[model samples]
Target chain A: MTEGFDRIVAAVAGMEEAARSFSDECRIVFLRNITIEGIDTLLTRNLYAERIRPIVQFGGYGTMVQDVLAADGAAGSDADLIVLALSVDELDASYGSPGWTSHAASAQLEGLFELLASRTRATIAVHSFIGPLWSEQGLIVAAEDRDLTSQTAALNRLVVEAVRRHSPRFVLMDWERYLRRLGAESALDPRGHYLWRAPFKRAFLEVWAQQLARVVCALRGRAKKVLVLDCDNTLWGGVIGEDGLDGIQLDRHQYPGRAFFDFQTTIRQLAARGVLIALCSKNNEAEALDVIDHHPACQLRRADLAAWRINWNDKASNLSALAAELNLGLDSFVFVDDSALECELIRQLLPQVTVMQVPRKLHELPPLLLRDGLFDTLSVTGEDSRRTRLYQDQRQREQLRSAVHSIEDYLRSLETVARIHRADNGEVPRIAQLTQKTNQFNLTTRRYSEQDIRAFIADEDVEVFSLTARDRFDSLGLVGVLVVFIEGTEARVDSFLLSCRALGRRLELAMIARCLAKLREQRGIEISRAEYLPTARNAQVADFWPSVGFSVTGTADGGTRYMRLIDGHAGGTPTFVTIEDD
Target chain B: MTTPAIEGRFFRILSSLLQVPLEQLGHDTSRKSCQAWDSLKHMHLVLALEEEFGIEFDDAEIADLNSAAALLDAVSRKVSA
Candidate 1:
């Protein structure tokens, strides 16, 4: 009877299960990268529209690209596929004829680089991995090979290129991978309804939904809201105030103490990965700071933490303070503490916070840390990289404060030479990232992918102004993106986002003023409209238009949209950006 | 003397990631590993092998590792059972 049940399970498990078994059997299957012939189906209206339906329906896909024919026949330009699994309501908001739209979920400026990469010469490959199709009644999954050698690759690339180039938002979930995954899952479940798949032999729909989730991740970027770190037992063995600096155990000698030193180093590495590390200690701050500095075994420095409310403050409060200083929600942070008391406290106070309890032992730290790292991996985008050096530049700029009298004089003193260029294929990724992350100065706050930004430029009516400002504070790097959408010679400043690292220097005002004038002259537009989409983080720009000499149109729905007509060059603010290198 | 099949077990494990399964795994397969053996997979390979043999390799060893044969030879030293 058991053998019969096993046979029945295998039979009913369907192709999805078969696929999993295939993976387990070959269990050794390698990722086969086959290039493509060309991207044609992506540009095909039927399939492009078809794939978008499920994403708009099931995934929280607010924006998507439809059909696009590449202006340039470029090679080596790849596609980042997205699978959209949306609810039924969100579907119609996208999948509309022509332009695309979606509700603002996730951080606006978060996936800018991915957006930009998906646009321009890049392809915004969209696939319907989940949700019910327009006429069909099941999940939709589309993803495939995108290299030039294989048919699947060619098909996906073509769609990706089209999606990347044509629309501001796109879903990228190829069907091929979904089917394989579905097959695998089904083979394992034998019941097809579970994660593996069932009811259908092939179970392509499940693949579609799962693939859409993957694509959404690529688009939204991982929300790395917090960096949880262990104290006392983890950072330095024994309590800080209790054990004292010399007394505390770290990496080097007895027990697994050295691993703590390595553990700190790993935390520092996470910081580089853009995870904001925080301290949850049952120790004194001054003493811990001393340990961070004086301890030869210490891997993380005091400056590495964005915020630490070290004291007898319950770890919940410490985690809260860290969240506030980092300007992130408590729900966004992952809290790691060795003490069960602290972890439990944070768990109670900020239930949303990801609190990890370290084992009483030290050797278990690395594996636990590594697994957590996977959970919070923020599929790094181009703009993500700007944080470490950008913050470093900001800190260095802050040091030169007393040296300058007024902010304007400071701007002038920095010998700030900004190179403003039209958004090309190469610069779109950086521009998209800026558009996603720069909230304090972002005007419209319309988050875009590299693919969307590329398409934005290809529209003669749309102008994207990419600015790279290097002041005497430091080369803030390619720090700003200004997008202007024009309609019948009337232009609307769609988005103006600048890095927070470059804030407080009046660069946003100066750059926007300059770009608007430039776009006005180049496009010969009469009026340029800009809006202040009030986000919790973007209040700084709430009065930006009024401050910069643009008339506010009206305040409606709690957002202020404004416009101005510039017949001549919008004057450049002779700003000083002092370069302070690390 | 060990069974040649031991090496086959190593290659078959690699085949899941390397794409070149048991049939193609030769001793001279060399460090040019396989087309599928990209950097990301190299990381996963290290992780899987660690789980398989309950051993850990530093980043230094990761950089040193390349071919299936080289990995197996290294694993042979680390594994007891």
Candidate 2:
């Protein structure tokens, strides 16, 4: 559905008055060739509700090259994001010309990227140009390879290539896809281009701004991690309890049944990309498990889910229980159901969880689930695809916990091995992901991007270490990251975090003690310093540094500063765990 | 739609976009009288009107229809036609 422009303007007007009170600011610079005025208002309207203020600045008209290449001018050096929006008609000299070619256009884009890759630390978003609505060559242009459409296609290929070449820094905005969705006729306004060179219609601009806001949310690591679903009509066409398993409508080959089949398939694919699948249904536990494990048309199995609650309990309670079982915050959940009452109750009780009610039309189910991109993450790593298995492995560990008598005996029987090593360039994304997503066990709570992690890996004075652990049951992929900055004889722990899957194994102590030992032996670091910056979710780590034999030096504003003399301290890895380092 | 209905919708959009009160907008109101109706706001106002009414105005009409009376006259003509 399209948003009213007046509503956006009114919302932005209200946000501008209270902008200073927002806790976080996402500074975005739009380096565009055309007039892009109202998008900032739309972006503010999108991000303000989440307590993030977006400060949208602009480069001068047709000054993209000058802005990108500037060393200290009004480019994006201090900005969190830089968006390159191009108007091919204005920037290209060969547009609609007889001797038109994509050479100059591609070269210009490459030049901008080269400058941006070296000069700017902000995340770059480049727009993909679309074909014009009306071609100069008329109907003959439809079949010709030398037409403007073809040339623009060639240039888009170059854009894709450039994004690939400078990945994790540059992202494609996919304007051409949005154009195709809106259709060229409704997307562009020729009169506006003629009047002020603002090419896109207001509707198209709103959609484009929404897309960009989605990218901003993903980059800020605000993507939902869990998808909790109701079972009755949400996953199948009928209730599994009332209607027999044979009576329920879920067939991959039929009409209405195919829709639910496709919806399950989409949820499974989301699970493959690190979103934990969970069930919060009021059904007979045995029946639901039977449907999941034995139903021929079901795309998901019982093993795909990380946790579930198939009881008669209220949905709000079930959702909270699922979050606790998974050791995730309620804010990381996205709940979906076919019952309006259930959805409304969860929305009222757990406002942090995003709730989606199924649309009335059955065929619209899959698109509605994916319409807003609630589960979109910036990049998928190897740890992401194996996340569901990691949770299932946690279930096994819980079973093992109950089997053993003493805590030390339990940890020793598991035969845990932790490999703490200096991180290579390939582990930058996973390390950054841990820094962003790990909350309860994180010290200092400093979030970094892949670019920042890459820089730390390459810096001579900084050491970035990754920790991967394996027990008798399964291997937990890169589950911890420790960033240490060395200055003279002092080593400061800039960031230390462990994933929830790697928690409760006494591995954090092993990780830190091993790294501190290496820092003293190889890097000649005598005094080690770390801080416990308290956050809303990280109270569990308040006394962690003290437990590791670091004495408190000062306390201010509820934050504790810690320092330790590494030479005299007897910090050792836990006897139950073995640690290997590079 | 009746003229009063169109007038009511038009004034609501105009007041919201220009940040002007509905009571102050009248037939005699023009760009010279409204301090908030600058060139950029004028273009936005036109675009919003076109989108809301599901009609397009001529380029010359966009420039000439600066007064409330003239805008009403042109919109009425388009809607009725």
Candidate 3:
């Protein structure tokens, strides 16, 4: 989203006051073996636009490895991320000249990776070496293994292999792929290199900053999660009401029909990886459902969507209803429609939702959606693959609730069980994700990354627990996370949040009681402290701590603090819910 | 004097990139006159000028293209050549 070098510079210059408005701050350290003075300005400008305050530190030129080694005892130890940007020429010199054999160069690179792994605790991102555009070996460079090009390939392989060993913490930027995409001639300016010791062109830096900004956004859990689609010409060639199931042009054999088929296939794939799909169509409900149910060429079915609003109502109201039914914030939704009027209406009514205007030509739709990077994610978990099924099960439970007369009988007959366990390494990503995404029921909304969660688990005084709920319908996966900091005879709850799907069942009370019982058994804690910080969406939990027998201690900075004695108050677990500990 | 068309568009880009008032930039405007025109911004100005005029500058030309007058002269020469 960064425009150009000059625009980015102007944005960075005005960021001193703009940065104070952001809630999250990320510390990034840059270590390059070349002159990289321009990168900081570019990165800062883009990051500030995303509500991320970047505290950047640049090491001296040509001292990447040395600075990483010195970071163990220096101020860089506190950095959340460390980026190593090394040019291929500098790497060759560091590995004892380009004349060294491929095997020897690979061995030296492996040692450097090992040193870097042992020396730094922050997440590491290293740039893969870009091969020189002009190889003196000419056509021989394509034939049997040459020196410079082959050495670059070997080094890139070593970098990728190193990342595999230290997965989820070490990542390679793949500058070789970036260079190929940008064309090597435009990416590297020989004149800039010789004049100012800057190896990359200014234009290349503009794109580089944009790519890194996406990575940073994904790491911070700001990726969009829901895709709200329109039905008429947006999904198929014609309106479902006019073109019936058999008349719509969605087949794979035609011109525009094939494009619609491919777009539907793309949307189906995104659903498979936990992106919630919803439909908002201004048409007869029976007609739309018939097309989705009976169309042979349709890749998406009614079951694929978590919810839908198929009526003659305006799209803005339908979208609002869909967000409420799914228990997701509007900010997490991306709306795609082929109608310019509809897109403009939603943009004005709900400014938080990301609106993507589909191009008039059907063939241009898929590429435009794919290139936006709206649904980018760094990693996927098993829970993501089972999201649609969980929502379907939730609908079944709602039906069962209406049939029963009493609330207690409905809960007891469903046979709900709460499984509580200490969060381990495998569950760190989900825990961090819940902390970032859960807004309605979150107390003291503090977002953490997987790296931050790992640090908490490694500490001696902190305790992290994850909760899972299952009933007659299906397993809800890890839906709750609670973090506590213990000191001698007292403990403070750092964060407590539950997924919206897991709420309204008294699961919060059960989870907290289990945590208290464990703390009393392990640390003999007497009291617990909790706080409720209200946000625009988290007003639902403003009085949650008080409802659980925690008395108000004080109020500060628009947040209420509460404390409760835990000497004999550990048995607050509700009777209808069964507890299973792992 | 240069053509009003060329000067009008050139000052618009300068004002937007530098985040300064249009009245503040003139032919004599240089790094010393504009608070935003530091060495880093100077490089960005060169890139913007190259993109606006569709001309590539050599290292010597880029290094010398500091003031508003120098940029206009170089771009005019490249446009008329």
Candidate 4:
């Protein structure tokens, strides 16, 4: 069994490389197949029962489709998702028939889909194999005797194409291809099968596990709302610390340092694409700020960042203080450190933080951070390009952060600008990413992917909108998202969340104001209703409903529901903010 | 494509799977003295040898597979058959 599995492991390693390449274009997680046929069939059965059963215990698998030889339904309740590894004898007779597509087929597939979908807790069996990734869209796949790789890719394309066509909420891995890619060595592997379910590489598995964590995050609206970056050695090389001004490399150049500089440029551009970039570096503040201020090839400066945190302090404390000052979650932040020891220290102290180790080899930094879709983006919005500059503009909002120490006075000052736009097909992807990530100020705090967002929008009662805020210092890139369900004057707030960066500025009030305005203008209502459910993070918003003039209502399911009637509507930003109409 | 090379490869696979002493696995040595040469080993050796040689073995040949010479004769007949 060990030697067999060794072969299986080697084969899986080779296929794992292919899996990476295909998943880049399409989402084919893995392909695994094993046949246990030998003279000692009874012995093989015992091995399957004792050894294999436990391995697939948490995996999603279907029952052998006796005649069709396909894995068709959930193997059992614990088996959330799966495709069966069936032999020719398992193939069912009605497979190519018409009656099978009737109500029976409906009930059959539905039961299977439900078996796995309910395990959305685990939701497995996203794919199967016959020839390859796409031999026939209808069935899992027909196992081809040869040309395994080509067949696997084809099946993968089929699954993706099917997903695109039906728009069903499915995330699947391809096993046949995954196995062949794993090869004969892995095929014969006897590590028990549990290891096969893991990614090709153990190091890569950490990233995959992180992705699962992200899925949980987006599910809970706990996505990092902003990324606070540092200038000098952090963003570019040479620093102003010792490199003095011009010595710093900012653009593409010679080996080593040039790559670090290029990565910094990529970071600046990523910020523009709507990753809230804030400069948080410890320096003379002025001397260090000068490199950004006076560099000839500098792609970013005070004008490009949403905010700047330049002061002398231990970076771990600085990052923690940065989170508190911004009112963002510690879990939602990714801190990059050029110093290995610093990164390690931060990793030890603040494990939740995604501390990216700036490779000692400078050039490798950019590609390392960018690949595997670290900042997996499904869509980029029109509001993104203006992000860096908006942060610079937002400085005006922050100086105001102190100008009116009182929250109300802060709201009253600096004429506020907020532009609310209904998200359409073009904006769905970003909207979904936001809905998946935004918490804190979030009302209902429901997370959705681009695909899920589109499906949710199909319901008539739900209305979704994104908020773009610009204050004296910055035009915070689409910092707020609002999801509301309505029945006449009673508007149930399904999900309302704002980027924490936009918190000290009272953008939540702006989002609510917009909601009220939409109710009156779009829905033709003079009255509006809302709710506030207490969450661990959004306790600040526990009183948000009452503060917004919402009347106390009864609590059910241990959740406080609020109601309010706006006689006349004014959905707009505060005095300090000026909404940029998209 | 040549028959001789294929048959040689067949004998080589049989020798390994059956654990028959290579020197004694000649054309006439029956399955009598080979300690590993049992009915079950016979089938396993046949399956693996068939895979390596690309020839099918019948029940008679499978039964008659006592010595290397007998195995060769049975395999050649199947190859021709």
For the second chain, the TM-scores of the candidates in order are 0.75, 0.93, 0.88, 0.71
Q: What docking tier does model 4 reach? A: incorrect
**Whose DockQ is greatest here?**
2
- Could you give candidate 1's per-residue lDDT for residues B19-78 as a string of tens digits? 455577676665574666775456446645665556666545666778766777777767
Model 4 residue B9 CA deviation in Å:
38
Tell me the tens digit of each residue's lDDT in model 2 across A1-582: 355576568667866878779777898999988887788888788888767888888888889878867766567478888988787777785578785877887888888888888888988888788886677777684555788888889999998898888777788888888877888778887888888778888768878888778778888878899999999899999988788778888987887788999999899889888899999999866677777876788888977999888889998999999899999999989999999999899999999999999889888997766778788776778998888998988877775754544466557656689998999988998998888888999988899999999999889999998999997557999998999999999998999999999888999989988889889889889999989999999999989998998999998667889999997454767898988765
Candidates arranged by DockQ, highest first: 2, 3, 4, 1
Best by TM-score: 2
Q: CA lDDT, every prediction?
A: 0.54, 0.84, 0.80, 0.55
lDDT (10s digit) by residue, model 1, range A49-133: 2222111211112333221113331211233332222221233323332222222212221243244444534323344223222
Q: What DockQ results do all the predictions give, each relative to the true complex?
A: 0.02, 0.34, 0.23, 0.03
Candidate 3 residue-wise lDDT, A1-582, digit = tens: 335555555667767797987988878888776766677788788788778988888876766667767735222567777777776555555433435445655665677677767776777777788776667565664444546778678777888888888876787777776677788777887766776667887667766777667667778987888999998888888986677666788989998898889999889888887898888989866567666766789889978988778888999999998888888899899999888999999999999999998897677876665565678676667898788778777866775755543455446545579999889999999999999999998998899999999999999899999998997456988999999999889999999999999987889999999999899888898999999989999988988988888999999889999999986767668788999987
Clashing residue pairs in candidate 2 (N, C-alpha, C atoms within 3 angstroms): none
Query: In terms of TM-score, which candidate is stronger, 1 or 2?
Result: 2
Off by over 4 Å in 4: A1-154, A163-168, A172-226, A265-275, A286-304, A344-352, A370-395, A400-582, B1-81
lDDT for position A356 in model 1: 79
Residue A488's lDDT in candidate 1: 79
Superposed Cα deviation of residue A556, candidate 3 (Å): 84
Q: TM-score (0 to 1) for chain A, all models?
A: 0.36, 0.66, 0.62, 0.42
lDDT of 2: 0.84
- C-alpha TM-score for every candidate: 0.33, 0.68, 0.63, 0.39
Model 3 residue A432 distance off true place after TM-score fit, in angstroms: 66
Q: What is the interface RMSD of each candidate, in Å?
A: 15.1, 1.3, 2.8, 12.5
Model 2, residue A237: distance off in Å is: 1.5
